[model samples]
Target chain A: MRYERPTTLKAAAQMLAKEKGQAFILAGGTDLLVRLRTGFIEPDLIVDIKSINGSKTIQKTATGFKIGSAVSGAELGEHAALKKAWPGVVEAANLIGSKQVQGRCTMTGNLCNASPAADSVPALVAAAAKVVIVGPKGKRTVAAEEIPVGPGKTSLKKGEIIESIVLPKRPPKSGDAYLRFIPRTEMDIAVVGVGVSLTLDGKGVVTKARVALGAVAPTVRLVPAAAKALIGTKMDKAALDALAAACSAACSPIDDKRGTRDFRIKVAGVLARRAAVIARKRAGGK
Target chain B: MSGITVNAKINGDPVEFICEADETLLDVLRNRLGLTGAKEGCSTGDCGACSVTVDGRLTCSCLVLGAEIEGHNIGTIEGMAHGEELHPLQKKFIEHAALQCGVCTPGFLIAAKSLLDKNPDPTETEIRFGLAGNLCRCTGYDKIVRAVQDTAKEMRKTNSRKGA
Candidate 1:
């Protein structure tokens, strides 16, 4: 095995583009290091990306925020402005692992790891997050959801490295929330996860909304039907019921020891309704 | 592969070491530096037996690569004591008997210390959430939780006295 900690994105990309053997990006290493130690993955090279400039800081945009790839969950939670702007995103990122893991796990790593149950992906999908990538070719932007093609897989080409995640600006009276069903109280993968983001008009009626579900598909699923169910109303029981049905209808979860497929299908709707309600409340609702 | 040189500040002291690319921080601290306080329980992040603080952030040392510690600050259970004087969390663990076989004590202490550093007067729920990563199979966690609670109370009282 070999290790290289390049201080520049171009250098890192050039090294990755030239590498012949299997290469892995090391950011936070909450997952990669464990994989390396357990023989789950034996990459010939490890590229430590934290040494790259601007990969570990959060930058404020004219509207939203651009968080670096190596920014740990602890750092995201500490950013009072980011938390205020995107509480659901921050909370979902913090929910990925334990405090120990939180201190080291990165949102970029979580999304790139592409776990079906990754706590960060659903919220990012709902927030309409975009990933900036640098490869041998050059820099480009891609939707966060487009990166995770399947479980433990990514669409990122060889020699491509994700630089950061850009959270788009939110309209006024907009809020988001993420909720996951875990059998354990903490540090467990989600059986079902839901993220809901919505905006309300001055009259307290839902005008725009996005609903996303995780652990129920190969990648996080953005259910437009679920969002439609919540739109054009005060988020009343009938609308919430429609949202739940849409969420349950959209699920394609696998049955395992953690949870049965039928149970996951049922809870998907439940969590979607609950998350939407929380989001509504956060958006200055009654 | 070849060994890589790593430079970092550990427990307020400058340290340098040569480690392989695949070596974990837990392996280096225990096998190389003889800081055997952080044990490899699960060798995964699930079990917090290898808990430490890298750059003042609590982390499972097993989950971090030794080669990545360049220009970082690390704190382990071995540094919880000042010469013969014990840190409050360590002293309180002894006072409360928060251990059975003692394999998980270092992790619990480091995790609790991390919590106390961030929030000196954390609620019981916060304490539980903070230490949830560190699992203790023995003693049912009641004793460990009580030890952390006592340590927090003492630390708060000490801080208030200093302020006064």
Candidate 2:
């Protein structure tokens, strides 16, 4: 295997373009190294992005926060501004692996890995996050939902690498929550993951809602039907039940070692309902 | 394969080594520098036997490459003691009988050191969460937790005495 550490974005893009899909970008190596050791990925070249300047920063912009692709999960969890603006996103990023794994796992690696079980994907989808992609030609931004095409697949063309993730500024009285069902408490893959975000008007009614589910489909799924259940309601028990049912109906899970299909589907509904309730409480709902 | 030179401060010493492309931090630490305190139980991140402090963060040495350690500071279990005197946590572990088979002792020690460094007064739950990554099959963890609590008391006493 060949290793290249480029210090600049342009140099990294040139290297990526030259190697095309044969090159894999190494962020924290929490996932990539394990995959490489297990022969899951056989990239001819490895591009180390840690040396790339300005790729490990998290900054606030006029619109929202810009999370650099190489920002570690631990860093995301500890950022005070991110915790206040998008707590669910921080929670999802924190759930990626154990403390050791979080120390090295990057949000970009989690997203680009494109696993349906990736913890951060559902939260990013719920937050309406945008992915910034850079390549030899130039840079472009795409919706998080549009980035992943299937399991372990992405719409990124050859030589394209994710640069950052952008989350829009959250309005007041808006909150988000993410929860996942795993066999063990920590250091286990998600059987099902749910992210819920709601915006409440002054009268304590949900005006806007976003619900996303993970590990229940080919990719992280945004259930519009579930969100619709809370669009004009007060997030009452009946509304939460309706949203739960919609989320369960929208999922297409498969039986695997982590959990059975029936169990995953059931837990998906439960997590979605719980997340919605927590998010509602966060949004100042009674 | 191009030879990459990794320069870092390891255990309070400036260390430099030439490593191969696929060489992990564990490999460089064990084979090149002969710092065998960090054990390799499961090469994967599941087993925290290879835990090390990289720039004040607990990380699995097996998951990191040697080239990633440029300009970083690493602290292995070897850095815990000062000359012939053992660190307080190490002394407390012995007093509280925190080990039996001793295979997982180094990893546990490093992990416990990390916890105490971060939160000097960690509760039992906090300690459990802090050391959750490191696994110990022997002693059932009751004694280990007691040892950490005892170590915290001892450290606090030492600090108060110095202040006085």
Candidate 3:
């Protein structure tokens, strides 16, 4: 396979525009190389983005944090500001694969891969993250929830590559948590992943909430009904149960080698409830 | 395929090598430099048998391209020893009998080196988490943990002596 390591974003975009669909963007290459060797992808050219000088930065901006698409999971987990503002994002990044995999896996790559089992997607979606894409058409941003169209499919057009991920400023008295259920802890795909973010009023009632699920559908799903169930509620056991039920109802899982549809649906509810409890605690709820 | 020249410090030695565009860091370490310490058990990065320290970060060499290490410093198991004596972790691994088949020993040694470099005194649980990437199917990990703990003590003793 041919490889091109562009040192600048413009050069990389220009190369992608020139090669079009024949070139694949390489960041980390933890997932891409595996797919390539396994015959899952046969791109004629690989555009290496590691050489791009500015693609590995994590900076705090007016809009919160701009995480470069090429930032490794280890870097994300170790980022001081990221850990303080969005601890769930750090937790989710840390849960991907293993230490070796985390050393090379990128958050943008995880989202671009569009795997239902990707650990980072639920957290990003729950955080209402936005993705910056650069191509021959210039730069555009899209909501994280709208980025993936289906399993292993994205809305990104040809020649476009994810530039960075933009997270909104962390709201006061709000916290997020991401939890995934896998048969074995490390190096296994998620059976059911849940991410929940809740903002609480002084009265301990949830003012706003967001819930996202992964590995239980064709793509990571945002459960609006589940979020609505928690809004204005005091996050009691009954309310949490209702939210979990809503999350389970929202999931449309298929029976696969990893788990049965029934098991996934059941665990989706369990994980959703667990994540909500953690988020509630983080939000300083009683 | 394009040809790339990678210039980096490998095991405290400055080296330059020409690598194929598709070549991974693991390939260069093993095939070109003959540093076979980083074994390729699973090129997919799951096995962690090809773990190495790249610029003070523990990473799977198989997942990184050779060209990606332009000016980075890398440490393999070969770097864990001094002139006439082995590193504390290496000596402790032998004293603690942390290996059976020895296939996973190199990866374990490198991983232990990384963990100790980052945190000189890691708890058993921390050691387990730090070495979670490296898999050892032979030894049940009890001996490995013991080896690391014992090496930490040895290192502390050596440091204290130097301080004295």
Candidate 4:
């Protein structure tokens, strides 16, 4: 295997494009190394992007935040401003793995790994996060949910690299929260995960909302019907019931060792309601 | 094929070695540099038995490539002691009998030290969560928790005395 650390994103993309054999991008290596050790994947070329300029930074852009693809969860947790601006996204990123894993894992890696049960995807989708992709043809931006197509797959074309994920600026009285149901307290994959983000007017009515669910579909789903249930309502029991029903109706999960399809569908609605409650509270609602 | 030469600082000592692109840092530490304190309980990152610090960040050495450590600083369980004097956590672990078969002891010690380094006086829950990555199958973890708590108190007392 050939290992190359490129100091520029263009060079890294070039390396990946020029490689005749299989190539893999080494971000945190929490996932890549595990696959490598288990003989799950044997790539002919490994491109390490940590040396790429601005790949390890969390910058405050005029619109929102630009988190580098190489930034670790620990670094995100330490960024006081980013944490405050998008607590749910930060918390979801921090939930990816154990403290040891958190030291090296990146949100971009988690998203690109494209695990339907990935802890960070639902939250990023609900937050309307966009990734800046750089490839042989140049740069393009896409919604976070557009990246994952299926289990362990991504929409990123060959030689296309995600440089950074941009989060939109949060308006006043806007809050987001992510919740997942796991058999254990930690180190287990999510059976069902939910993320809810909403903005409230002065009268405590939801004006804008987005609801996302994970591990219950081929890709992390952004449920407009569920979000519509919350919009224009005070998140009362009636509106919450509608929200729960919508989330349950959207599930097309499969029966796996972690959970049954019916159980995951049931938990999806439950987690969505609970997440909406927490998000409402964070937005300064009673 | 010729291996890649890597220059790194392991436990405050500058060292250089040649490793394959696919060689994990855990292998390089044990095979090439002869630092076997970090055990390989699971080759995967699930088990923290290979716990070490890369640039002072607690990490599973098995998950990191040796070639990636070219300019990084590494802290291992071997660095936990100062000469003949054992670190307080080590002394407390011995007093509390925190080990059974001794395989996971090195990982636990490194993890506890890292927790204390970040939060000098971690609550029981904090200590439990901080060291959650390191799994000890032989010991039930009560004694290990107590050892870390006792060490924290003793270290805090020493720090206060030095301040005075």
What TM-score does each of the candidates earn?
Answer: 0.99, 0.97, 0.97, 0.99
- lDDT, candidates in the order shown: 0.93, 0.88, 0.88, 0.95
Best by lDDT: 4
lDDT score at residue B77, model 1, on the 0-100 scale: 91
True contacts kept of each: 0.91, 0.53, 0.68, 0.75
Q: Write the per-residue lDDT of candidate 3 for residues A154-193, one digit (tens) a residue.
A: 9998778888999999778999999999887578889999
What local lDDT score does residue B11 receive in model 1, on the 0 to 100 scale?
91
**Candidate 3 falls in which docking quality class?**
medium
TM-score of candidate 1 on Cα atoms, chains taken together: 0.99
Candidate 3 lDDT tens digits, B1-164: 56788899998799999898778899999999999988999888877888888887888898887877889999888887897888888888899999988878888888888788778889988999888888889888999999999998889888889999
Q: Kindly report the docking quality category of candidate 4.
A: high
Comparing candidate 1 with candidate 3, which one achieves the higher TM-score?
A: 1
Instruction: Report the C-alpha lDDT of model 2 over A1-286, residue by residue, as the tens digit.
Output: 7788888878888888887457888998988888877778888788888877778999999999998888999899889999988999999999887778888999788888888999999999999999998987799999998888898898888888888999999999999999999887787889999999999999989999999999999899999999999899988889989998999998999999988989988888899999998888888887
Q: Give per-residue CA lDDT, model 4, range B1-164, as digits (tens).
A: 55999999999999999999999999999999999999999988877999999999999999999999999999999998999999999999999999999899999998899899999999999999888899999888999999999999999999999999
Off by over 4 Å in 3: B160-164
Ranking by lDDT: 4, 1, 2, 3
Best by DockQ: 1
What does DockQ give for each predicted structure?
Answer: 0.90, 0.71, 0.71, 0.85
What lDDT tens digits, residue by residue, belong to model 4 across residues A177-214?
A: 99999997777789999999999999999999999999
Weakest lDDT window of 10 consecutive positions for candidate 2 chain B:
B127-136
